[model samples]
Target: MVLGRGNFSRSVAFRWIVSYAVILLIPVALSVIVYSQTREIVEYEIKRASVAMLKQVKYIVDGELRQTENLAAQLTVHPDVRHFLDLKAETGASAYHIYRTEQQLKKMLAANDFLKDIYIYSNALDSVLSGETYASARMFYEMKNQTGTFAYEDWRELMIADHAGQYVQLPVKNKEKKENTPSYIRSFPAQAGSGAAGTLLIPLNAEKIKTMLENIDWVKKGQVFIVDPNGQILFQNSENVEALSATYRKWIGRGTSTFTDTFQGKKSMITIESSDTSGWSYVSVFPVDVFWERARAVRTLNVLGLALCIGIGGLLIYYFARKNYDPVKELVNVFSLRQRQGTSRDLDEYTYIRRNVLETIRERDDMKNRHVRQLRVLQSYYLSRLMKGQTDRNVPLAEAAMTHHLSWTSDRFAVLLFYIDSDEGGTTDLPLSQFIVSNIVKDSVEGRHAIDFTDVDGTLGAVVNVAPGRADCWKDEIEDALAQAYEFITARYKLRFTTVGSDLQTGLDGVHQAFLQALEAQEYRMVLGEDALIWYGNVKPSEGSYFFTVNDEMILLNLLKADEFEKAKGMIDQIVQRAFQRQTPLEMAKCVLLDVATTLIKSIPGPEQAGVAWEEWRPLKRLLSCATKAEFHQELHDIFDKVCGVLRSRQTAHAGAGIGDQVAEFVKENYRDPNLSVSMIGDRFRLTPQYVSRLFREQIGQGLHDFISQTRVEAAKALLQTGASIDDTAARVGFASGHAFIRVFKKYVGITPGKYKALQ
Candidate 1:
C-alpha cells in the first residue's frame, strides 16, 4: 500500500493537479481576503454618500420655506394690502382696494410653485381674499367644514385674534386621499400699533417635493424616505413606509446618526439626517450587501470565474499529463510483451520499468550471440557437407552465405590438415583429440581466416582463405605455423602433429576439392616416416573405392522398423565393410560409417520405443572410442541389436493383444491415398472399424483420422522444403482440395500451407 501510494504521488497527473490547483487557489484566497476586508469601507462610503444626498434635499426644502416666508413678509408691507385693511365700511372705494390687494396675492401665488395658495383676512372689513376666491365674511369657511389649510379654531386664534406666541402642528388625519397642506400664517402690522389688519398665509406643495425626491434613482433602489420627529412618513417612494420610518426613528436619537442594525442574518447601514427648516428627517437604510452590491457582484463573478478556471485547468492538465505519460505507457507495452500479471502490483513503475529494460537488454544480447553461434554452426556444417560431396541442390552456396550473414573476403581457398597421433601417455578418445588439435591449429595460424571443423575422427581440418594469384605464398607461413602447433601439442598433451597443405584452388568447388586432395595427402604425410594414424575406419585403413547410397540407409531403417534384426545387422555390416574397402585416405570410409551410425541413432523411434535415450546408449561417442576395427564393428552391432530388439519386443507384445503395430505401419505406407480411412484399414486388417480406430488411437496417441492427416501434413512439409507448388503439394499429400490443405495445415502448423512454403 505504501509503495502504491508513493508511485501515485509521483505520477504526472497528481503533480499536475497540485500545480494547477495551487494556481487556481491564489485567486480564491485573494477574493476571500478582499471580500472580508472591504465591508466597513463600503458601509462608510455609502453612509457619506447618503448623508450628502440628504443634506442637499434638506437645503432644497429650506430654500422653498425661506422663499414662502419672504412672500408673506411682502404681503404684510404692501400698500394695497394696507389700504384694503384700513377700510371698514362697504363702498366702491373699499371694493377698489379689495380688488387691488386680491390682484397682488394672485400674482405672488402665481410666481412660486411652493405656495398652494395665498390668503389674507381682516375682521374690520369682515372679508377674506385668496388667489382663487374672495370671501366677504371674516371666516369664510365654517369650523366643522374647514379642511383646506387649517381648522376653524386655528383660524379664529391667528387671523381673527392676536393670540399667537408659539404654534406647533402635527400631521392631521383627513378623509381625502391627498395629504393636507401645511400653511405658514403670521399676523401682520399689529407690532406698529396700526392694529392687526389681516394675516398672510402660504400653503406648501408637499407632492411637488415628494416628486423631486422620487427622481433620484440611486436612493430609490434602497430605503429613501422623509420622516418627521414623530416617526410619521412624509414623502417616500418606497414600500412599507411607516415601518421603515419607525425602524430608522427607533435607532436615531438626534439630528443625524450613522449606525448599523441587523435583523435576522441581514445587516444594514442606517443613515438619518434631520432637516431644521422643515422639521423632517431624511432616512435611508442599506443592506450591507447592497452597500457594496457592486463588490458583491464582483465577488460572485470571481467565484464563477474561479470555478470555470478550475474546470478548464483540470482538463488541460489531464490532457498534458496523459500526453506526457503516453510514451511511458508505450514503453511498458513494449517491455511487457504479454498481458500484465497480478505479480506486477508489488513493483512500482520505475522499478518495474528499470528491471524490464535491463532484462530486455540482456535477452537481446543473448539472442544475438546465440543467433551468431547458430549461424556459424550452420556454415561449418554446410562447408563440411560440401567437402564430403553432400551439398543440397535446393540450397545454393551463395544463398546459404546470404541467409547466414556470412562474408567471404576471398575467392581462392586451400585445405590445411592437422593429424593428431596419440602418444603412449596421450589421450585415445577420438573426439577429445580432434578438439585439442583443432584449437591448437586455429590459434597457431593466427593471421589467416579459416573455417575449421573436427568432424572426422583424429583429424582437425581447416579451409583457409587464400589471396588470388598468391596461393603458393601461404605454404611457407603455414608450415611455420604447423611447427608451432606441433611444439605446443607435444609439450602439453603427449601428442604428435602432422601437417598437409593442399594445392591452392579457386571457387567454391575448388575449396571442396582442396579438402578432398588434402585428405588424399594425409597418407603421404604419414608415409614420409611420420607418426602413425591413431584412428582409421572401423574395419581397416582407407581404400578409396567406397560409398553408401540413400537406398542403402532406407533399407537399413526399414529392416529395423520391421523388427528384422538379422537383415538390418547384415545390412549395417555390408555397408561398413564396403565403405572401408581399400579406403583412399580415410575420408569417405570414415564419413560413410559415421553417417550410417548417426542416421540409425536418430531413427531410433523415440526414447520409450527403444528403451534407449541419447544419453543411455551414446552410440556415436562409444563407437568413436573403439581402439580396433573389431571393437568399432561390435559397438555398431550392439547399437543395432538394441534398437531392433526394442522394436521386436513391441511387435511381440502387441501380436497377441492387438494389430496396433501393423495398423500404424499400414497408415504410414498408405497415407497418400485420400480414400484410406479407418473402415478401409479394418477391411485390410480383417477387423471392425471401431476396433481399428481404438487401436490406432491407443498406439499413436491420436485419432485414426487425425493421425493420417498429420502424417500427410508432415510429408507435405518435406515436399514444400524442396520448392513444390502449393496445389501440387496438396494433391501429393492426399488433401481433398487446396482449401482443405490450407485449413488443416494451419490447424497443425499455425500458418497456411502457402505461408509455410514461403518461409522455407
Candidate 2:
C-alpha cells in the first residue's frame, strides 16, 4: 500500500508539471501568434497607405510635370517665339528686333519663377537669345560642350531624331556653371525635320523638387526617389544612400506597386507609383521594423504578464491563457473554414494552423494573378502614351520591358500601323477584323519580335520591336510576316489591309518618333497609291516648297478669264493633284486653296452688276475648318464650280478685254495730263490700281505708267529733233518742271534734250 501511494503521488506530480507547462506555454504562443499576425496586418496597412499616398504624390507631381510640358509646348508654338526663331539674319538683324525678342523672352521668364530661364536657339539668326544674354548659336553649343562629362552631341542627335512633340533630356548638373540645377530641356517643333530650329532649356531648381518631396509625411524616416524613364536617378532624398539595390530595384523594375524586400541591410517595404503623364516613378521605402514596433510592445507586455502570472496563482494563469487561446482559436477557425468547410470538429490545433497557412498561400496567388493583369493594363497604357508622345521619362525601358512581359529580337523598335479598308469585313463588330488581324500577325511573327496591337484613334496600330543591322534585310522579314498576315486575313475574312511601318529607331525613347513616321508613311498612299506595304524609308519626304506660286495661279486665272471652264476645272484638278502627290502640308494646301478661291471670287466679272450675291458664298470658313486633304479638295472643287458657274452666267455681261480695253482707252486719251497715272485710270474703270496695272500690262505689253513716260519722252524727242525749244517741248509734254522733263528725256534717250538738240 505504501509503494502504490508513492507511485500514485509521483504520477500526480508528473501530471501537475505537464499541466502547468501547457498553461504557461499558451500565453507565449498566443502572444507570438498575435504579434506575428498583427505585424503582418500592420505592415500590409502601411504598405497600402504608403502606396496610396505615393500615388497622390504621383498625381501632384504629374500635374506639375504636365504643367511644365504645357508651358514648354506653349512657348514652342507661341507666335512671338516662332517669329523670333524664323527670323533669318544675313549678317545681323536690327538691334531693335533683337531687343524686342529679348524683351519678350524676359517677359515670359519673369511671368514664372519656376522656369530658371527660357532660351530660343534660332538657326535662322545663328544665335541663342534668352533672358540671360544674346549670344551666337556657337556660344550656346560651346556652353553645353562638356565633351566626356555630358554627350551634347548625343542629346542633340536625340532631339533632332525626334519630331513627334517634345524630346526630353533628364537632369544633369552643369559642371561649368558650378551650379547643381537640373535642367528640363524641350526641343521645339517636336518632330524636328532637317530644318529643326533649336532647343528650349528650362533648368529647374532642385530645391523646389526637394521641398515638394520633403513636405510628404510618408517618407519621413524613409527614402524617396524621382527616377527617369530611362532608369536614371533624377533626384533622391538622401545623398548618402547609394543607387537602388538590385533586390529592391528588381521589384521596382518589374513594376510591382508594393513589395517587401531587404534594403540598406534591413527588411523594408517598398512602394512605387509611376506617372502616366510624365513616365516618371515615385518610390517610397520604409523599414519593416516601423510597423513591428506596436506588435513588439504587445509581445513585451505579454511576456511580463506571463512572468507575473507564474507566481500569482495557477487559477489566474489558467484564466489568462484561456482568454488569449479563445481568440487564437477563433482566428484559426476563420482561416480553417476557408480552407476546408464543415471540418472544424474533426480538426486539431495543428490542422487549423496548416489550413490557415494554405489559405493564405491561395489568397497570395490570387492577388498575384490580379496584379499581373493590372500590370498588363498598365503596359498598354504606357504604350499608348508613348504613341501620343506623352510617355514619362522617369521609368526605365528595362523596367517597362519587364512589366509588359516584352521580348524583342533587337533593341530597335518600329511602329506599324495596319489600317483595315473593308466596310463589311468583320460583320457588325468593328474590332472583330482588327482583332483577327492582330492575333494572326502576332502568331505569325512569334519568337522573332515583341509586338502590341491596339486601336489608336480609329485605326489598328501595331508597334513592332525588331532588331535590324541592315534595314533592307529587316524590311524583307517584316514584309514577309506582314504579307503572310495580310494574305491570311484576306483569304479567311476577305478583309484588305494597308500596312505602314516606321523606320527602326534605337529604343523605346524613339517610339513616338517611330509612330509619327508610321503616320507620315500612311500619308504616302496619296503619292504611292494604295494596297502596298509602305515603309517610312521608302516614302522619303519630298523636299522644296509646296506653296502655290504666282505662275501657277496665273495659269488658272488665264483659263478662267478665257471662259475655258473645262480647262479651268482641269487646272484645279492638277493643282490639287500636285499638292496630294507632293504630300504638301495640310495647312499650306488649305491656304493655297483659299488663295485660289479668293482669286476665283475676284474673277467673277462684276458680280454686283450680274445681280449675284457672291459674298453669301464665303468659303473661307469652310476651307479653314477642313480637317483632311480630301475635304480640302472637295471644298476647293465646290468653290471652283460655284465661282465658274457665276462667271459662265455673267460671260455676256463683260466680254473680251472688257476692263482692260476701258482702262487702256482712258490712259491713251489722257496721256498728256501730268496726273494721268494708273491710279487715275483705275478710278475711271472702278478697278484697283494693282488690277489696272496688271490688266494694262497684259494687253499693252508695258506698264500703263511706263507707256505714259514713253509717250511723253517720244513727244519731247520729236519736238527737240524738229528744232522746238526745250522749254516749249517740256511744257507741251506735260512735264511738271523743266528739270523733271530733262531727267526723264535723258533716262529714255540716254542724253539731255539740249545735248540731243546740239547733236541734231
Top of the candidates by TM-score: 2
Regions of candidate 1 where Cα sits further than 4 Å from its true position: 1-33, 89-93, 137-139, 143-151, 161-178, 229-232, 238-240, 243-252, 262-268, 287-289, 302-760
* Cα lDDT of model 1 by residue, 479-559, tens digit: 666778778888899888666666777666776787777776555453232542211222224434436777777887776
Model 2: per-residue Cα lDDT over 253-282, one tens digit each: 756378777777888888888777766677
- Angstrom error of the Cα, residue 128, model 1: value is 2.3
Supply every candidate's count of residue pairs whose N, Cα or C atoms clash at under 3 angstroms.
Answer: 7, 14
Q: Report the C-alpha displacement of residue 599, candidate 1, in angstroms.
A: 99
